[model samples]
Target chain A: MKIGIIGGGAVGLLFAGYLGQKFDVTLIVRRELQLQSLLMNGITVHKGGSSFTTRVDSDLLTEVSMKFDFVIVAVKEYDLKPLEKVLELMDKNQPLLFLQNGIGHLEWVESLPHHNLLAGSVEHGALKENDHVLHHLGVGKTNLALIKGEWGAVEELVSQSIPSFPFLLKQDFEEMLLTKLFVNVLINPLTALTRVRNGKLVENPHLHQLQRDLFQELLLLYPHMERNVSFEGVVEICNNTYENRSSMLKDIESERKTEIESILGVLLEKAQREHHFVPIMNVVYRLVKGIEREGLGG
Target chain B: MKIGIIGGGAVGLLFAGYLGQKFDVTLIVRRELQLQSLLMNGITVHKGGSSFTTRVDSDLLTEVSMKFDFVIVAVKEYDLKPLEKVLELMDKNQPLLFLQNGIGHLEWVESLPHHNLLAGSVEHGALKENDHVLHHLGVGKTNLALIKGEWGAVEELVSQSIPSFPFLLKQDFEEMLLTKLFVNVLINPLTALTRVRNGKLVENPHLHQLQRDLFQELLLLYPHMERNVSFEGVVEICNNTYENRSSMLKDIESERKTEIESILGVLLEKAQREHHFVPIMNVVYRLVKGIEREGLGG
Candidate 1:
């Protein structure tokens, strides 16, 4: 089985390294430096104080000409627009899996004429240390669900998953993505704005109050979310990832672009469509954008 | 007339230096270091390219035994609780003026037996360079209004104002404080949370959107405020103080206690009493308090 992962980021690297153990994996990258490094030294993933290298075929995103059995789009949601044409040009029968954060891309993906489409929520915490090196911090499994077409491709990947790296097939894609979005919406922007570690969100009483308020706002849109994902579950995530800075917070500190638009931006649009007032989310959404604008010199 | 100024902060020093030029001013400070420095070097006002030194009397707040015809309480609103007993022991006829931010202190001041009570909004921009030197940045006048008193002491102070430091008498105290509160509520927390200067609130479009949302929330409680304080006026203040870091921002950077409780806390209480929904205010309020907790090791 041939699997192609588009994005040389942390998630893409982790997927390529783990999936390469069982299948032919190709890393499609845009940056020439990352492509050269990946082709020359291969991908190395560090987990539990041990590191292993996996050799995989690499190609520049612009020069990718080979067809794959399954392709995973792992780039950020904001970065998905530029690759829409590339994804469209692929074979219609080829199954495509999107591993981006937030459900904002679902609408864009629905517009594509692909026969088999899959959406995934990556629960594993992976950090890119260098061009070809990744640090796998958490051992959480990737949850995959069918967005459109048959689940044949998703089942094949789940059945062939490597040891210590697991893939779980979920029935409902929207619920899976919404659960991830709920956690991201509550944790990412607040942690970014406060510039604190994840644990501080629940540990600090005032921040906890703000988080609860944000949770209440989210519940207004999807009242059933309270049952599936309790407020305590969100707090537990913060406590479990106690010492790690959120991706949004890291982006702000490093002056990199954040995925806030993919997260809170989409949530706000949904709230507006439903005529539900989510003032707390609105405030945080604008604040993260403002901070991003200031950091990115926009 | 003899005047006593309590609290040796920037506002206290600014008041003593200017008011000393026209009256016998005694700077009563809590810090022994500030008291000693004031007694030795007096108070120096640095404005523009020139500087002026005013030799005012100095006394420790705990050791002060002298009586004054009038007194100016220049401490922060949060610091007012500890001074309540001391304020009660002052001469009953001695008119007291509060130079603090927020209207939270109004109720406490009204309970005093003093014959006259005044609330003044200090518009001048003063930075404490040291224990004895202050940099007067903006030359705005102080707006004084009678809270609960005969206007005898206020009229005397206005009638005998010093040069370049003007004092204007306002008829409505609530209106005057609310106007100032409107600006502080909009500017202080946003700038502090973003760690940007005052101008960024209006300059960054995203931050500006958040500021507008906050303005709308405030207007919901005081609908008449739309007539008195225009949203543009708040933006103008941000533009005018473009390079200045708000006091709350400075406090956060320095790891000092912020006035979040006095400003947003008081506003939240009022919002609760009125049953008004101010979600944005609630979020920023708790975020600032959380940051304060993390910074101050609370």
Candidate 2:
């Protein structure tokens, strides 16, 4: 099976490196420098105190010449706009998987004519050191669910999964995505606003109070989330990933755009539709949005 | 006339320097170091491109012996509890003036048996350089209103006002304190949490939106406040004091305890009492409280 990933970010590079071992993989990057470097040096994967090099095909997103068995849409939600034409031209029968955070892309993905669409939540922590190298910081399973198609359509993807980088199947697409969304919503903006690691939210009493208040608001807004997961489970994630810096904080530190719109922005929209009052979320949403605007310029 | 000012903070030192010129002023200080410095060099008042020195008696709060015509409680709301014994020692016949920020001290002040009590909202910006020196950043008027007793008892306080530090008498005590509380609530926590100056809230669109949302919630929570001030009025203050660093932000930077409890804490209490939902204020209150805990330890 041949796989084509349409991003050169940490997640894209990570998937390429791991999947290149069993099947042919091509990384479609935006920058020429990243593409050239990847073509020259292949890709490096650093995991579990061990490093390995994997050879994979590389191409610019616009210059992809061959069709693949599966195409993983691994870019950020913000970068999805430019890939509209590319996605439209792709083989409609081939399965397309989205690995972006937040539920912002659900509506957009539903509109696409692709017959087999999959939504994935990447649980593993991966950070790109450079254009051609990535460090798999944490080993975790990727949860994949069918958004609008049969899971059997991507059976090749399930077969390619190794123990080190496993892909677990989820039955309900909404439940899986919403479960992930709940964690991201509570964790991402708070860490970005506070500039603290995940653990501090649970470590500090006042912050824990704040986390609980925010969680209460989230539960009130979306009670269905409560049936899927508990607040303690979320706190457990904070404990487990205590030292890790959230990607939102990294985005702010690097002056890059954050995924706040997809995460918090989506929740705010739902709150508005239901005419629910969510003061805590509103304040955080505006604050993170304000910080993002200042960081990214307008 | 003899005036005793409690607390050696910026507001306390400011009152001491200004009132010492007209009245025999004795500043009640907390630390021996501050008392020694004030005794050795008097108090320096820096304002409007000029500086001057004024001599005022300084003593430890425990050593305050002489009865005064008026006593100004210029300490923070948090520090007021420790002064319970001292407040009991104060002459109940003489008017006592409280010059703390926020509405947290309202109920406590009312509970005091002092027959003549006045609440002051200090508008002037004063930054203490050291124990005995202060720089008056702005020449704003101080608003005074009777909290529990007759205003005529504290007439000497109004009479001693100088040109640079004028005291403007306000008719409605609730109106005056609530007005100040409104400004503090809007500016203090936002600047402190975002670590921006007062002006950035208005200069940044998203922050300004958050400010407006918070202001709307305030108006809803306390409709009486709406009759006293408008949202545009608050924005105008933000514009006027654009370069000003909120005391809370300064407190955070200095690793000192913030006035979060007095400002945001008081507002949250009111929201709880009125059964009003204030999400933004709740989050900011908790976050600032969390930061304060971390800064001060436990």
Chain A TM-score relative to the true structure, per candidate: 0.97, 0.97
Query: Clashing pairs in model 2?
Result: A279-B279, A279-B280, A280-B279
lDDT top scorer: 1
lDDT of 2 at B261: 86
**What would the per-residue lDDT of candidate 1 be over residues B22-71, giving only the tens digit for each residue?**
89889999989888899899999999999999999999888787598889
RMSD of each: 2.2, 2.8
What DockQ does candidate 2 have relative to the true complex? 0.55
Docking class of 2: medium
Q: Residue B54, candidate 2: how far off, in angstroms?
A: 3.7
Candidate 2 Cα errors over 4 Å, as ranges: A40-42, A47-50, A53-55, A148-154, A216-225, B48-50, B148-154
Lowest-lDDT window of 10 residues in candidate 2 chain B? Answer: B152-161
What's model 1's TM-score? 0.94
DockQ scores of the candidates = 0.70, 0.55
Candidate 1 per-residue C-alpha lDDT over A104-157 given as tens digits, one digit per residue, 9 for 90 to 100: 889989889999999999989988999999999977889999989987666788
